[model samples]
Target: MNDLLQTYTFLNQAMQSDSLLCLAQAVCWLDPLWRGYDEDFYHDPDGILSAALVVTRQLFPDLYVDAIDKLRQGATYATVDQLICEGISNTGIPLDNLEYLPYGIPLPAYGVELNDADFYTTHPEVIPILACFGISPEANPYHMTIPDCVYTAAEIIATDLAKRPEEQYQQVAWGLLWLTSATNNSICDWDAELMMEVEPLAWETNDLAFARVMIEEADEIMGDVLTGLYWLTSEPAVMQAMQDNIHRIYKAIQKKGKNNDAPNIRLKWVDLAICPE
Candidate 1:
């Protein structure tokens, strides 16, 4: 098989695996609390700041584990920032001379900027690695927005999809669909909606009949629950149906191979499923 097909198969296998499913569940469970930091930070700076320091650790576990451990031991943000500075220094990227931006600036763009010649020339692996966590180096890279994290992740994935051949559109759609499903249960519905919004025109050319089938299945199985809660409730049967639908589409893509006749299914129900009414 070609590289794109190989990638499709790998992603499908990973999504179908039990471990990623559990990881999705864990992310969903913690999403509400993660979102709360947005509002809480303004009202309770210390508390929210501390919570953010801890959660931000998830983005760079290798570099931030020691920082996280210190935070758990009641280390303040200053202490954590010191640890991060040391970690960056250890990576040979000197941060002491860089000018810092205020916290909460837009992330994906900033992430892109970080990958530019200035930073990437010195830290070649930095952009791709930070892209994974939705982070870009800012002067004050100590803070991040929850929404930006979601957006950056989808943006990076979509950009990757775009760089591939047009025949891979179905795989891109399925990939975004899987990401949407995985992250939908989280506080940010915008990631899925953004994926839908940035959807390439190639996706619009998908087989309408197959698209309708997927939509109807999703509607029947999910109904208003998808919109009403902005997340899937603990409905086992419905969730299973959703998973089966995803796998069915995956199989279809695999069967079609590079035929270009593979269903690039898009659905009106997708908006209704994800957006708040």
Candidate 2:
């Protein structure tokens, strides 16, 4: 169990570096048993490393696929590590000098306490850091009060939106929409009713409408990859209302800029919205 936890810690740091070489190293570490492991291992009940890997793959599909191919060809972890080091050296990101921070460094920034064992259990990828902080596995973040962390995160984002620059509003809006949709996806199994509670908070500002229009315009400019924000919601009424508002606002913006090109927000934000924690 300790070995697995250590590997999870290493992979988590590697992915956060946003380095293709580091990501490839992490993928190689998992290649030995990922496909043959039991369902529970894949689900990663102790941490969210599996989900993080999925997000890493989505972000660097080509690089990840190449790493998978090498794994299939029976590449050892040492070999893969060496290859990653070589790649990092070529890119001037000094592999030898890279110091891995204690996993606890960013926890405070997220306003999360390491003692929240229940939260760590649900979000296993956080376990290593919490362990580093000497937080017991039995401790609870909210003293077992069962606080609504997701809703709280959304509220925080909404509160801060007005303080940001105009150029960042779209990104903030995208983050809000993603938070709502991803939270819904996570709860759709048992607590599906929670989404109804989240709807009003999501639409509190013009963000939902902005996200819808951005997605619609993205589909027109890029492709269908960004067209499914409406479907992310399980409630039909909520989905329809959001879609209607999106169309209304989108049309108004188009008419108001009849001779001008539509504003182009990056399509990558849609991909970011669905990224795993």
Candidate 3:
């Protein structure tokens, strides 16, 4: 465990510098036995490292596929995604078929494909950062919270905020911003629900920098959510789930402020029926 921890530490700092080299080294270090050990490892310390690798791969597609090819040949580079897929296929785990794994239904339709230029124009802000991760703006960022994408993204972000509470608020806040500004449908809601599960540590010892970033981002997102004020077209249950989550997030940020020096993050849900003119 200590060896794994140290390797992750080195990788984390390395990621701040040369991401590809760090990814290559981490993938090499996380031999198949350790990575493929079990499903639980994905949630443990290893989760953070695994997500870094996934994001790293996203940024460098050629490197990601090359690493995947290498790991597949080796016995130790098993992915939690592949394992879950295998269990669903081979074992009777009550999991959905691969096609329906992200949500228990078939994938939702994303209409009217656009070229990269047009797509980026549609989502000017989000595409650049996502592009750095190798996800074309054309690809859906909305999938970030789905089960298939969560282990690699949502949960990883959650874990990062938890262990490093000073940054938790900002992380969650930025996550919300990305969710609403960039994602389509219930995706942002999904990210918020996952993020709301983690409890932020007290403000005294936590890093104020991360918290500030989170607050700034959340404030921006709230503005957008309130201003756009569009009704969703997904199933009522899904939409309700998202609304309930929005309420929870609204309350959580309010509660955190009352309890600590955490930033006052407000979410204003507008009532369109009664417009003030």
Candidate 4:
């Protein structure tokens, strides 16, 4: 477990560097079992390394992929780096071009196609560094909590804040937008219970994050119910589930902040009402 953690830390630093050499080191250090493990490794409970790898792949696509490919082909971790250097020496991609800050979701891009409310329930702000990647919906900065992402990301946020807490917090923002829809007979008659409920729309937020929140002292949002927040079309109801999930992440951050000299958690909800007019 300690070795895995060391690897996870090294991997985090390497990706943060966003440098090619570090990328090589990061990929070269993966455990063989995990190095060549299939995608299901993500579902496994021991996915500490998985979340970091997911972000690292995005940070250094070419070299990371090269190293992983070589590892799968039986190259030792120690040699894969040299093999990659020998194979192709292209200049590394600079992630500085990406903006980690998240912005309002542009529903038009996806056609506001929320026949199912799940369409708008998305959390791209989870990784603020990803904002440097792109603002379009496709470049969503978030990774599914997967039980690992939130904890991992929160740790990153807390630790990173130590160096420049002010800016680190500014870089990443966590936003949750949940969408659940149903066919409405008459738009604004929700009190009459006139709409047909839509099946669960994943859209955003968590399972683990939600669990974290429920256990904490969330007296503020206790009365909160549904969060679908808009009416004209989807009539996204404002429900407790989404609010609860976001709060849970806040609690997790606070729990992790024990290490931070001054842990100031910044939690925000993604308002889906920004939909197309």
Taking the tens digit of each residue's C-alpha lDDT, what string does model 4 give over 1-277? 6999999998887777888876666655653333554545333244433432343354335655666666557664336545433332222211111121011110111111212223324532222322211122343424321233333343443343234323212222111111111111112112112222422212123522342333231221211111112211122222222234445555665687556433354534334344222
* Superposition error at 52 for model 4 (Å): 5.4
Model 3 vs. true fold: TM: 0.20
Local distance difference test, per candidate? Answer: 0.40, 0.37, 0.39, 0.33
lDDT per residue as tens, model 1, 1-277: 9999999999878776878786776665444234444434233344534444433344335654565456447775566566665664443332331112112211111112232345445544433333433445564443433333343333434444445444233233333433334323221223333433442222122432343444444433233322322333233333343344444455555676776444453221122234322
Top-down TM-score ranking: 1, 3, 2, 4
Where is model 3 more than 4 Å wrong at Cα? 1-119, 138-147, 167-169, 176-277
Better of 3 and 4 by TM-score: 3
Model 2 off-target regions past 4 Å?
Answer: 1-58, 88-92, 96-277
Which candidate gets the maximum lDDT versus the true structure? 1
Cα-based TM-score, every candidate: 0.21, 0.18, 0.20, 0.15
lDDT of 3 by residue, 1-277 (tens): 6999999998778776997877767776644333443336433344533543343243334434544455555524345345434433332222232333322211111222222245456655544333322346445544332222212332333333334333323334344334433333332333433433445322222322444444444445555443322222212332343344444554554566555332233333223234321
Give the candidate order by descending lDDT. 1, 3, 2, 4
RMSD of each: 28.3, 23.4, 22.7, 25.4
lDDT of 2 at 257: 65
lDDT of 2 by residue, 1-277 (tens): 6999999998887777868877667755655334433335333453333332332254334444554566558775445445543443343222331121111111000123333444456656433322322334555455643323333333343344324444333343343433334212222111224423343212112543443444344333222112222223323443343334344444544565654443332111222233321
Q: Which runs in model 1 stand beyond 4 Å of their true positions?
A: 1-59, 97-277
Cα lDDT, model 3, residue 110: 24
